[model samples]
Target chain A: MVSRPVGFEQQASSGALGSVDLGPADLVPFDDRGLAYGDGLFETVLLRAGAPVLWEHHRARLALGCDRLGIPFPCQDALDATWQGDPTAELEVLKLILTRGSGGRGYAEPESITPRLLSRRTPFQPVVKRWQEGVRVRLCNLRLGHQPYLAGIKHLNRLENVLARREWRDASIAEGLLADSAGRVVEATSMNVFWQQAGALFTPPLDQCGVAGTLRAALIDQGAVTQAALPLGELSAVDQLWVANSVQGVWPVTTLFSTNGSRLQRWPLPASDPLQCLAHPLLGFA
Target chain B: MVSRPVGFEQQASSGALGSVDLGPADLVPFDDRGLAYGDGLFETVLLRAGAPVLWEHHRARLALGCDRLGIPFPCQDALDATWQGDPTAELEVLKLILTRGSGGRGYAEPESITPRLLSRRTPFQPVVKRWQEGVRVRLCNLRLGHQPYLAGIKHLNRLENVLARREWRDASIAEGLLADSAGRVVEATSMNVFWQQAGALFTPPLDQCGVAGTLRAALIDQGAVTQAALPLGELSAVDQLWVANSVQGVWPVTTLFSTNGSRLQRWPLPASDPLQCLAHPLLGFA
Candidate 1:
């Protein structure tokens, strides 16, 4: 497996519509609709053993987002071009951002869209301690706004997550839990959450709000997980809890805390780790 | 008086976060939270006589968004640097995007946020005919999602607006009205809408959804308008309807069409134009 600290390198190019002449510009325009209106979609995948983990899943999610956002998305060839680099980096991070290129000063889709494909590689980072020892997460005060039209797909309009993340600053709190405007628990700030009761997996449905994470999708489709509208007051009902994402894999929780730092539930482990025997090799220590 | 066809030109540079040494590279990193998560805010202002038309108002609104989004905003001097180029172009549009710069993946606020300030100039295209003889607008099938925390601030995350604008493709339709998910009439695709009734001005409250347009704010603060939770079925009761923004100033709506191409209401212009004595000079042609 690859291993290195995260160091970022960027490259950008124009695609599809042929209007933008990005010409090897390694930086994106500050005015990219992605920045100006969060008018884009992205996928971050882990590079293990010098190969992108879950590349197909990432692509599928990107396509889903493009269809939902009505963006003429970058196809497989364009996405493959972004995976350029030496295979020797061992472990690295890969990010792909597909923006509606540059648009006029409004929200309307441009008549001709040159989907801007921006990709970058960074040193792979793993929350090693949290993965092994377990992480402590707290509930956030900021509530996610419900938008079915814009929910599920991992599109760029993420100010809600930013605001929710800002509600707490303790690095000790590995993640923050966010609830929808209707008080249904959704996800951690950056990852999808799953709970295990009697050894069956359950996750919150993202139909109202929250990103339908690639890994979460895989688990659910594989029958490894089920959807449920978990409430904030029911944390104690879980036999175990975990939050996961592609880059960092699955991290079991030691405790889930309320907004005021009161312990709501505890999922202490046996002398052995949980996911070690459960998750796929790519998702945890094999 | 200034007039010209709208054309766009753009240039990007590094901002207060000297961490970025932007040169001929002319690109932002893919890891830029702006693209990754739409972690940014923006302002589009009218440049009349080579000056930003609601200069103070735009700045104030930007500041409000920065404070809300928690981005360390670029000051006035940084904003001024983005307004370079010509003084002779009859009119040009200026757009500024402030992002949380580059950061690690996910929604968490970066440990060090060097806000990036990106600005561009585009030729100003005034809707001359629409200004003279009011334009026809249609109601969009897409509804805006309500997020009270993000309401009123012009932060980036405008996917709803993009989707709503796509509901209609008729060139004859100058604009479209978007309501929140709760059926409260909010705004046009790109402008704040106001209706005149009994010689008093009323606009939908933006507390649930919609941008608090600079011109709308100006009119409200100047005691020229009042806020209401206008429902979709009540448009016919208004004496006059208008949509306004900083760049286009204001345009009276001669007709508003339903999503299915049905006429909803009509406002025929007087032999002597109405609003001649009502609208401020900055808003319309007297």
Candidate 2:
């Protein structure tokens, strides 16, 4: 087992020469469009034995974000070369950020663009406990804005998520679910949510808002989940609910509460769940 | 006259003591929450004789943003002390960015937040020509998302504006107007829009989406303009139109074009438009 500190973090920036370890004090340029306007996209991936899981999904989403935002996609070979991590680590978390670099000032992107790629790695603390014993979640008072142009991509303009996540500080509440302005259940603060009804899985359609999570995409691609508009009122009728992201795998929601701490719904931790059964092998969860 | 380069830029960071000049090569920390999640607020002010125009308005808006986002407001005295600029210059632009500072990795803000204040100054290029002879604008294909929670405040999640601004590259097209997903005309890429209808000034209500511009607020407060829903269908019926911002002053729209470069409406540039007449003195447009 790797002897790295539990919360130890390391960062690097990629250039023509490959990855260069960034000193703790090294900063992003003051003029970086990312800091100035949140003009960037980021992906969080689970790395097992230093190999990134769901890398293809992350790259595809990044490429989609680049296309939508008019930022150029970084070369795959360069990204692969720069993403090398500590081979000894059994489990690690890697976050990749791609920004429109520095544009001096203003909303208009510079005539010539140089996209910057920065990567950070940390030791992963598996959510095995939360997964085994279903986690509790709350509905956020914060309703997500519907912008189809920005929906589904993991971009840096994430104040909505930040706001939703900050609504509650109760340690018992593992996550907060968010809805769109129209009262449609959209997603959890950090993960895509899915519910089972009559032996069929349904996740909220993200055409209007929410990030299209990599694991969520994989589930949909495998015909395990279907996208539908799950309104807040309809959530009570669902059989089983689960939230999933690339890094944390799948977590079943045993209890749901309103923002006011009033209990909304409760479920028993089942002996077996289809989502867990399907995701455990892929997520390497014992 | 100050002989600085036309686009020469200078940046500084403020701490307890005062603002320290940041070298061109200096970067924002890679872990800054602003870079991570666009969890910040920015204000661009017009500096004349080393003093920010409408300083109170900018500060109030910043305070509002901080309060709404739950980011701690920096001490006002520190901000005033650090805002000292080049008094010799007749006109300059100051861009103030207040981020939630370094938060290591996630969206959850650090418990003890040290909000980072970054200031950038650039030479202001007055749009006197556009102001005098009304400018041309186009309707962008991109639509702003409707999120009442994030509406009105000028936060860092500005990809919509960036996307709208990049929709046109024509030098003659001075700006692009954006509408929410529901086809309601909101504002221009970087300015608040107002129009005259039957001799009364009206601007779009930002209660749903769009930045509540400082200048727009000033106009509304002065009873010169009223907040009303301006739909895309009503643009052709308006008598005259103008876009205003803190930095650029105001520019009357002489012509409006569809995204495909087709002219939708044209208006004669009056010898003395009421908006120009009213805004000239306030904006220092001779």
Candidate 3:
């Protein structure tokens, strides 16, 4: 095992001091592997009353990502200390980005890595309207490529999602649903998706592609959801559908549109979605 | 088309003041989309005697990537200015990174983007020995996922290459060959692969996946190479094999090993390889 650099520990602790503004302290070296090759992972945590909701889940996922990429996980004390902030805001968004640090030109990892953890806090923009009254989502023309090795972890290589999200600029369309190259349903642009069939909850299996979200994990752990392969063709037959993430709680998808902007499927307003009900409290949603 | 931001032009022109040191001027803001979501493209140009090799090919690829991603291409005047440097070094590596500048916290791009172009020049470490005497390579277990939309563009989402490069630490192994999920030969960890079959040169098609190397494009343009779907199983039947990129030129594969380190195929030293002979002068190799 490669030994962690002492300088990294010190730098990380101090850098984790957290930033409210994009000052000099918030700048990363231009050669950072994160920017050069997307060699990193990130977490977006919702801060309610200054406490990070589902902090443990975020931490665990980050650790998992670090392990998969072979980057040394930063000290937990440093992370906790960095996460500490004033309890003034009613709601905030804490974004944590962990990168393999700066490296010389090439794809090889540096002899000794100085992992950098950058944290920024911004006021959370509430999507209560979408959360209350379902959202309209469309099937993206872009299909996600399957790389099992990089699957499930929310790594920094997200050009696919960026391209997928760029498919729709219509304000009415809240999200774009992505499918694997094989036509299997994966996830939405920034959230995990779930559908109900015969009163059973099912979400796409992420072994091939797509991120395994924290909110989706909590539901599975609580026995409210099961992993299954949902083909794009099978979506129209599902009873109910909802999209969720750690910060956005759950937004029911009321309308599904084809790539050409014509509606393919529509569902009635979710009067009471058991899946959303089970997730709202955990995500700190009203 | 989105109107190009004036600040970006000013920033690009100034930021291109080539830096040999990582100073405050060389730092990228943490919120830059390149670091956040790998929303960027990059080019590694070889400088032999202070002149960039295959410059037009590199510029065209970067522009193609920007157009594909809907990022406003940086002004050509700014890019040309940024590329100017003190023509002193015998051999230098110039890396240009163009990112969809800083954005608010989300996958959806900001209403207006200020694209950032980062350039750095470093002394090139010539792999003369690897170039002279063919190098040994092995097949990587990590298969590249096929994303047609992202195929062929040398974008910043290169975690696959990073992971594949990390698979083997044995310095003796010059590079690792990667195959697509369908077991079709794609490329090496950091270079493009070409092999001779019945006296015809063939390289993998980049439509499904793989970075279409500028050097590879140059070779193809000259009719020295043709694109074909190469199955991994057919490597043993090939008469000659070589891996190449702009910076490293062409390195003939002396040995090919399986993922487990067992010899899968071997090729005799090229007493006179026409492909390498065709590529040597273009790559500034003796």
Candidate 4:
């Protein structure tokens, strides 16, 4: 495990395991592993009290992602110190990016990998009020490519979301929902979608596509939601709807659009408030 | 047109106007850009001598890719110097990446954007003998997800290839060919495939999926091949087959294996000098 450094130079100079800082010079060099092959995995973590919220879960997910992408996982202590040392950062967003490191020209990977690990703190701003008031959403005309192998992980290959987001400019709509080639509702660009129907909470399964969100997984584990093979036709009958993700917690959906160009009015969530309870403690700004 | 840099530092410092020497840092951080969203397009031009093999074609494709992904065009003169200084560079591989710079954590893009432009030169080595003697290929089990919006261009979302490549460890196979969910042969991981049937050359169309390769386009323009909607069942009827890309040039297919227990017999290319007459000079290396 790599020890934490007091300053940037100390971090840079550290030959320690995962505590190595990829300085700007290394990042903007002629070839970045991130830019080269999209050869990386990342985690967007919500931090509380100068510490990462659900740090273990995030770390485990990162490890799983690395496993799926054939990247080597570093020691947990090294990763912990890399993000934990900033005393000045109390309530913030911590983004941990693990790249395969630079230098292969084409699709071929390097023989020996030097993983680039970045742990940075960002200002945490929650839109909790938006969940209460509800945020409008539109159906993105852009459909996600249906590569089953890449469906659920938060890897760096995010061009699908980029294209979907580029489809609209309306700020009124806080999110955009996407469908697969067979017209199955996948998830929103940045969040996972769940709908309440017949007194049950259900979200589309990521077995085929969409990010397997931490919050979504937690809700499913808590019996707050169940995974369903949702078709586009099933969306219209949904009584209440909400989107779940790590950063925003849970967002209630008031409206959605059907493929036939019709609006589906959404009902609010049921009495259960596990998500609110979970977010209340973890929300960085509290 | 932006002026070319004297060296790497001056280029790295110039943010959007000039080609940045891609290292580890972003002048304007694209951390949120390439990670949270895959908002970028790239082109790999094979450089022989000091000049990129097909500049006009690469430029046109890059422009088309940028338009498809809704990114602003990168400055051309800045990209020109990517291969200028290296006089001793016998063969160079130039990677050009254009990205919409970083933004807040959301799907909505920043308006009035100054896109990130990066170019890097790497030592290029081709499997020239493999192209001449014929190479082996495997049909990947992982299917390509269909998304017409992102079907053709060499955009950054390439988890599909990463996963597909991880399927095999046998170094003998040159590349893995991917098929869409519908069981139609799409293209190779890094190159496009073409087959000859009854004296007519047919390459898979990229309207639904696969990269619209510059070499493939040039081959079509040069009357070396024609586009067709290919089905996997017709592989046995193929008289002669080859894979073409900007970097690999053209590789004759001696064997193809399907992941799902299916195997293909090897077929030799036409044993005549006429093939050399039709092959591109850059493609006819070995």
Specify the highest-DockQ model's number: 3
The clash count of every prediction, one per candidate, is: 7, 2, 0, 15
Off by over 4 Å in 2: A1-26, B1-26
* Model 3 segments more than 4 A misplaced: A1-24, B1-24
Ranking by lDDT: 3, 2, 1, 4
DockQ values, each candidate: 0.63, 0.71, 0.88, 0.49
Candidates' lDDT values, in order?
Answer: 0.74, 0.80, 0.84, 0.69
Query: Please, what are the lDDT tens digits per residue for candidate 2 over residues B83-156?
Result: 57445467877778888877733767777777777676666778688878889999999989888878899899
Each candidate structure's TM-score, on Cα atoms with residue i matched to residue i, is 0.88, 0.92, 0.94, 0.87
lDDT of 4 by residue, B1-286 (tens): 3453333222332233334334443332435475445567788888777677877888888888888887777665556655556444677777777677566445567765656666556676777587568888888888888878778888877767767777777788888888888888889888888887877788888888788888877777888778887787887578877777877777788888878635777776667523334656744364
Q: Report per-candidate TM-score of chain A alone.
A: 0.88, 0.91, 0.92, 0.85
On lDDT, the candidate that comes out on top is 3
Global lDDT for candidate 4?
Answer: 0.69
lDDT of 4 at B194: 85
Model 4 steric clash total: 15
lDDT for each residue of candidate 3 in B128-214, tens digit (9 for 90 to 100): 787779999999999999999999999999999999999998989999999998999999999999999888999999998899999
Ordered from best to worst TM-score, the candidate numbers read 3, 2, 1, 4
- As for TM-score, the candidate ahead, 1 or 4, is 1
lDDT for position A79 in model 4: 73
As a whole number from 0 to 100, the lDDT of residue B204 in candidate 1 is: 94
Could you report the Cα RMSD, in angstroms, for every candidate shown?
Answer: 6.4, 5.7, 3.8, 4.6
